[model samples]
Target: MAIIPFNKPYLTGKETAYICQAVESGKISGNGGFTKKCQAFFEKRYGFKKCLLTTSCTDALEMAAILCNIQPGDEVIVPSYTFVSSALAFIRQGAKIVFADSYFDNPNIDADKIEQLITSKTKVIVPVHYAGVACNMDKIMEIAGKYGLFVVEDAAQAIDSYYKERPLGSIGHFAAFSFHETKNVISGEGGMLVINDEQFINRAEIIWEKGTNRAEFFRGEVNKYGWVDTGSSFLPSEIVAAFLYAQLENLDEIQKKRKEIWNYYKCLISNTIENYQLPTIPYFATNNAHMFYLICPDLSFRTKLLQKFKDNEVLAVFHYLSLHKSSYYKDKHDGRELPNADKYSDCLVRLPLYYELSDKQVEYIVSLLNY
Candidate 1:
């Protein structure tokens, strides 16, 4: 028996060639030719007001936390079912995290419950698009407008995905995207921050360049660059940007193949599986086929399901443990029971659905589930 791994990053065959060209061009530093090209590609394609390439999605979230002006004792609402970066970014800014629950039917933040979480100290809502599915952005935006709160979309899994006709990253005031090897697109480890509000664009660039007007100075808008605010080194080298650009150039082909894999998995599983809930892509969201996941009936069932994979020489995986219940945050939580989030934490299982996963493998996995 051969093992089918959970994930395998697909390369476009141009990554090293672009990296070599970038190396030969004599600028391997950040914000050079390749960086600009990647940024321009996103802005033009997504209609983002401004785009900045960052070292990772975590860095992009950190930049969003800064742009939101989070302060000590401020509050940020984040879904408990999300990765820690969604909450940790605001927490680093000295903001208190108010963990929200996921919807009973899906892993998105329960939008209807968002208002109850808002308070005088509330400053931002960090919505993570779990598995690349959109949260209810319309409701979220309405709540934000009513309370004068900022929205920083954690679009790490949502590259090339959409909310209605609008791109996922463009709907929020600020959005962060991941280009981790595990994602549909691969640059080893890279990300982007999108600013939809015009007012924050200048400050965003300053923040991206380590709190200096260096970007302006270099563009001839200023005579000298000086440190004027707080920031850190968030830029990735041109080598990373070059690799990312190569991936970006093949976005359509990559997406098409990924979607094909995802569809095949869904078709096979629907015919064979009877006890698990498949991933849900809402009517308002476009699936990017970032990953395919299942919700077992209970934790015991999920444990058995994972063991079955091991017995069959396959590797499926569980997703996030609810941040509210994690060792670090359990005591800090406000004590409201987030049943749905905890349920997902205990029972969600993600199967292999990468660009390279084959139809035969999908059939085998589904057959195993049926057995």
Candidate 2:
């Protein structure tokens, strides 16, 4: 039996050529030619206000934290069903996390409950776009406006996704995207911080340049670069940016292939499966094919399905454990219970859906699951 992975990165034939060009250009450092190309590509492609590539989504989120002025005792709202970096970035800036409950049908934070969690100290609302499906951004923005809070979208899985015709990353005050190997696009490990608010662009450039006004200096806007503020080395090497440029160039093709496989799985198993639910497409959200998942009957059933996949030389996997229930956060959770988050975290199973996966393979996997 062939081993089908939970996810696999695809290379679009241009990676080696671009890397060689970068090497020959004698600018293999950060913010080189290739990096500029990638940044420009994103700015034009997504209509982002200002896009700056970072070493990883973790770094981009950290940049958002800085831009939002996250401080000690400040509170930030986040969903418990997302990756730790989604919340930990702000937490590292000394903000207290207020874990939000997930929507009944999706892992995104419930927008209706957001207003109830806002307090005087609530500084930001971080919404994670789980599995490429957008959260209710309109409601979130309304709530933020009412409370004077910042919105930082964790759009790691939502590169090509849209919410009511607005691009996912462009809707938030600040947005972070991932180009990790497992994502629809691959840069081995890379990310981008998108600033929609004009006020954040200057400071964000300084933050990306290790607390220096070096970017302005490079562009001849300043005579000399000096230490401006607190920052870190968040930029990636030119090599990674070169690879990412190749991926960006092929974004449409990559998304198309992934969607094909996702649709195949849905069509093959929708009629045969029982006690399991296929991923839903809300009327307001457009797909980017970031993930294809199923809701199992329970935690035990999810585990059994994963083991069954393993036995068949496939690698379907489960998602996060609710952050609120984790030992690290449970004691400090202030007695809040995220019931919906807890339920999805325990029962969600993600099947393999990658750009290079074949339709026949998807059918075979779905057939096995039905069996």
Candidate 3:
């Protein structure tokens, strides 16, 4: 039997060529020609008001935190089931993290419960679009509007996915996207910050350039650049941008193949598993097939299933131990019992669903699950 890893990064055959081009252009540092191309590609394709590539989605989230001007004592509401970056970004800016629970049917933040969590100190609402599935954005945005709060969408797994007719990253005041190897798009590691509010655009560029006005200086809009604000080295190098542009060029084809693989797994397991729940895309959301996960009835069953996969030389994995219950944050939590978040944290198991995973491999993995 062959060992099947949980994820294998895909390439479009143009990554090396683009990297060579970027190298020959003589500017390999952050924010060069290739970086502009990648930024322009997203801005044009997604209708994002402004897009800036970052070293990682975490960096993008951090940038959003700065743009929101999160201050000490300010509170940010985040779903407990999400990756730590969603909360850590604001937490770094001295914001209090108020973890919310997931909806019982899905791993998205319970939008209905958001209002009650809002206090006078609430500064922002961070929504993580798990597995590229959109949360109830309309409700989230409405809640944000009602309280004059900002929204930073943690769209790490939501590239090319949509909520209703709006693009996932375009709905929020600021959004962060990932190009990590495990995501639908791969650039080894990369990310982007989408600025939808025009008020933040000028400052965002300065922030991307390590708190300097160098971007304007480069464009001849200024004679010289100087440090104008507090920021850091957040932009990705041209090499990273070049690789991401290669992936962007083939986004449609990649999405199509990934969706096919995702559907095959769903079809195979829909009726075979007695006590497992598969991923669901609400009517208002479009699937980008970033991952295919199962919710086992309990942690013990999930553990057995994972061991079974390992015994068969296949790799399956779990995701996101609830951050509210994490050793670092548990004591800080306000004693709210987030049952649904903990439930998903213990029961969710992600199967192999990469661009290169073949139909035969999918069948074999499903066979192991059925056994």
* Residue 275 of model 2, lDDT score: 82
lDDT of 2 by residue, 1-371 (tens): 58998878788999999999999999898999999999898788779999999999999999999999998999999999999999889989999889999977888889999999988999999999999898999999999998899999999999889999999999999999999988999899999999999999999999999999999999999999999998999999999999999988898888888888878777777877888877877788988888889998888988888888899988998889999888887887878878889888889988898877887788778866764
Q: Write the per-residue lDDT of candidate 1 for residues 215-298, one digit (tens) a residue.
A: 999999999999998888999999999999999999999999999989988888787678999998889999999989999999
Clashes of 1: 0
Best by lDDT: 3
Supply candidate 1's per-residue lDDT for 24: 100
Write down the TM-score for model 3.
0.99
lDDT of 3 by residue, 78-118 (tens): 99999989999999999899999999989999999999999
Taking all chains together, the TM-score of candidate 2 against the true structure is 0.98
Q: For model 1, what is the C-alpha lDDT against the true structure? A: 0.93
Please report the TM-score between candidate 1 and the true structure.
Answer: 0.99
What is the C-alpha local distance difference test score of each model?
Answer: 0.93, 0.90, 0.94
Give candidate 2 misplaced runs (Cα > 4 Å): none
